[model samples]
Target: MGDTRGISGIGDADDIGDMGGIGDAGQVGDTGLSDGPGQAGDAGGADDAARAEDAGRADGSSGGETLGGRDALLARAVRLRESGHREEARTLLLTLSERCPDDAEVAYQTAWVHDTLGLEAEALPHYVRAIQLPGLSDDDRRGALLGLGSTYRILGKYPEAVATLRDASAEYPDDGALRAFLAMALYNTGRSRDAMEILLHQLATTSQDPEIARYRPAIEHYATDLDATV
Candidate 1:
């Protein structure tokens, strides 16, 4: 569930199937998206582990109602997903989305479910809706961006992915994950200069984080020359 954008969750061009959610379990405004489907790629937002470890809440920032019933249902769904009961979780989320179609959180969760299940085609529109909706939390918003942007990359919609990831970066300037995804999109779209620049920026800024720092050399290599890569 993911990225600088999920505005709410998001990931890389290579499957980015590494699905997951953000925050502690049962936390307020959680995207409630998670539980890995054992897919091939490691590209996705927050991740199944994040969703399993963290609970989701209503879209508090977006003004979606944070009623007790909704919270309970969301928590249950999260548990189900975490426990590898993805279909059950998806079923619950679908019901929730139907009951509250305009609820950005619900839409976001629905998108997450589809994304987790490898239904990138199905997940796209819901991610768009969640992102467009006003009452989303920053995490959810970024996650939506992550989901939407990542899905765009998966569909080979490089321009759309670039635009979406750039929009996400504008909002989440410091998000390394989003930047990496953006780099891939840019590279794919023949915007290697922009891609390398962003990658360099990410390396410079995220050097303190071990996970991100490891990508520095690769980024440097990628940035130094685009034609060679092509």
Candidate 2:
């Protein structure tokens, strides 16, 4: 089998400073003047309010900065990978992941780049993180599942490979690539008969070759009953 790496709200707060002690009837030391809405206490309260507003703005800006250019960067990384500049793509994706650590797309793309570079071990954690994290697009989710399962198989984790690929195949029952990978994993786990059934079924359904097309009915029949005498 070919080892192909398939890669694809907030709220505000309120002022709790007592509004310059509006209810306080007592005066300061001996000045005989009660604190009011615009006194020193009130000024301090205003300063606090201003500081809070400034903090809120800073937080908003910081959030924007975190993900501001992430899409552009991700696209550039993808372009680099597609163009066969895998090393450069890996570096760019690494930087993007660091900047957008919680970003699902960043995590997925990072894993894919590592896979293309033959760094399956390094790709493992990113794949796990991307799958666990939410907001992943449907296409990327499919790719991530296939990549994770294939990587597990490559690493000799046959059981994990089978389980992951089985789940993926269930989720995407019509995905031939997933079935192909799952069949390989099944063979690795000594289920060669089951594996052949899946491969034969896939070939019968998806192949366009004239020879296979001519024999499609036999292939489909044998796929389910490999030992059938008739």
Candidate 3:
């Protein structure tokens, strides 16, 4: 089972967020989001980060503070995020985004910071933009798909969540995190049995693959819980 759901379980959104393997395993917001073929922000209590630097840059207030060159800006933004300085990161990334609206990475990272800030409404368009761009790393593209899917869920767009997750799953069926997230969305939309069935199938497959068998316990426990709860 290349399904990376870990044997001990579906775990926390905080934990799952780091699954992206983005700037040191790009993370997501904790709770309900999956590193599923997709994953959000309350990381390290980094979730509820300080709004100290929020200067309405997103609205064009401080949008003109040049973040140096593209590479420098990217490096800085990644560092700010890794260090849990999300507000500053968004500020820098937002400026970078306006200067390079066509740059997919800028668009994506801007959205990432917003999602981290629990500003899904703000993150929404950028994620969508990143997804539509022509050139993106396979992982980053998947990240966008996963991010947008999770964003839709957070925004109560269950149908969009289901659709987007399903689309990503089709492309990466081996991604267990993505599968777990799909199950969560399915369950949310009144498809508990369907969700449980998917987890159970993944569990059975994981049990057969020695390479990933280490994750079996988590899957087994989660499956049983799904059986009981849903």
Candidate 4:
């Protein structure tokens, strides 16, 4: 399955700051606090402020600059992936993960690249690492959980898959996509009744969503077959 999470444009304040002189400080002030040839001093102050701002922007000091070397590398890897250079992107992400073993974003992006490359075995540990990252966004954590569960399901680890998907569903209880994935995992694990229940719940809650409606036939088919089996 593709990444269910939507990708938004990165809005690094550093990049904006790098554009130079976008702030009012670079413009001459009319405060009239000084009298003797104050224009030169004001111009000099503006130049200094502009230079400092440029330097800060180049060093990525704005917006708290919390992302470390590994995160930067992973971000570059993501760019490569977006450009359709999958192999190079995978290599960059893997290198970043190796370089910064404790960086969660590095590991997370590595796993994402592995999944894109169909390297399920290599992806599982990274997904687990991503979920364990402290203060990860709920959306990111849920995505990692779903990815892990889906990978396990593909590998025939049905019990693990079900447990992982269940955990993800609990974390994102209102997520129709997570619930749908959980239902599929349940069905694959021989818990057809549970799958039917999940499908029915999804149908009830998301009847108006065109994407959910598209799955109705398969859900109904599964529900009917489950009823017959029981």
| Highest lDDT scorer | 2
lDDT of 4 by residue, 94-148 (tens): 6556556676666666787788888888898998887787645656666778788
The TM-score obtained by model 4 is: 0.66
Report the C-alpha lDDT of model 2 over 12-79, residue by residue, as the tens digit.
11111211221122211111122232232222322322333333344353321233234434554565
TM-score of each: 0.63, 0.71, 0.62, 0.66
Q: What is each predicted model's overall lDDT from 0 to 1?
A: 0.63, 0.68, 0.62, 0.61
Indicate the worst ten consecutive residues by lDDT in candidate 4: 27-36
What are the RMSD figures for all models against the true structure? 11.9, 16.8, 13.4, 12.2
Q: What is the lDDT of residue 48 in candidate 2?
A: 27
User: Where's the lowest-lDDT run of ten residues in candidate 1?
Assistant: 7-16
- Evaluated at residue 181, the lDDT of candidate 3 is 79
Which candidate number would show the highest TM-score if scored against the true structure?
Answer: 2
Query: RMSD in angstroms, candidate 3?
Result: 13.4
lDDT of 2: 0.68
- Which digits, one per residue and each the tens of the lDDT, describe model 1 over residues 83-181? 566677677677667657787887887788788888888889889988888788877777788788989999899999999999898899876788888
| Cα TM-score of candidate 1 | 0.63
Please give the lDDT score for candidate 3: 0.62
User: Which 10-residue window in model 2 sums to the lowest lDDT?
Assistant: 9-18
